[model samples]
Target: MSNPFSYPTTPHVRKHGPAGYREWENYRPWLRDEFDFRCVYCLCREKWGRRRSSWVVEHLVPREKAQHLALEYSNLVYACSSCNSAKSAKWVPDPCQHAYGQLVYVTNDGKIHAKNADGRKFIRTLALDEDDLTNYREMWLHILQSWKKHEPERYRQCMSFPDNLPDLTQKIPPNNTKPEGANNCCYQQRKQNKLPEIYG
Candidate 1:
């Protein structure tokens, strides 16, 4: 079975470049699709809990530090509330520029191990190795494993994309640098039957 906790092997390339949203909150839907409905830092999925309440639109560079980029699409990321709070005003490697899978690894025991200094800092900054997070990861790992083994349908539901994929085509940002990306959004892919049922 595919490990749901595995991180991306390559740095994320921006698929959407929406701009001119006055409030960063307006970018939540875009960020959700861009990051595959998970926390960019910790890999927490939207399926795990209440979506709107649990997830947040995070700034790659904190607003306090870069006020100009507060609404910039490139500077936005999708993160869980816990990771966002832990990373408040702190700098770590950019997820768009770094392949986290190369920097860190999540073991079967639910412990996160860093492969280098950057990874170490990333984990520390986000408190990714804390007891609470480890316990959370371990619990999910076991649940997913059991579901995959005994209840394949439930496992597919947990591993699959959320039902309400945002329709990016209807959204009109003031300026979209990559207008073509809208066609590749998860909603569009699902419409075309191009989206995979389960993402590893």
Candidate 2:
């Protein structure tokens, strides 16, 4: 349950068109790969979230503050809408610059505990320990526990994949069969620059 990196590795941001939300939407597929199709803050996936907008393209620096970089790919992050909204226009340590795992830990029951002051600030700023998020993470933990108990092989496959729950939902095939490409669906989709079914 202990994750090593505070933030996932930063993906290369490809340059895109001039400033606009539409232009950023085009970069979602690429950004998804960089973020492993999970929210940068909460690590939720659109496939498993209650809302389709659970994961979205967020600007690390608000467009209102830095209009010139509105379409700058490097500034973009795929975050759950709730986290993005909670973070609205506030400046915090950049995940890329600040180590998150060192600052906070999500307990077995899903409450997030800050390891230090900055971690506390980050958690408080984003409401990382809010009831809804805690409950959601607890549910995921139960699902994972169930998978580990009842479907060990599947659980291992899912656990081995870096994308966590989404890897289970989108990439790992069922025990009895394989997909057409002999690959995880997400990998093929990424290869084709195709967004997931939800995005369609």
The residue pairs found clashing in candidate 2 are 6-101
**Judged by TM-score, which candidate is best?**
1
lDDT of each: 0.90, 0.61
**123-152 in candidate 2: lDDT tens per residue?**
888888888888877876777668778987
* lDDT of candidate 1 over 94-192, digit per residue (tens): 888889998899988789999999889889999999998888888888999999999999999999999999999999899999999998999999999
Error of 2 at 195 (Å): 17
TM-score of each: 0.96, 0.68
Worst 10 residues of 2 by lDDT: 173-182
Please give the clash total of every predicted structure, in order: 0, 1
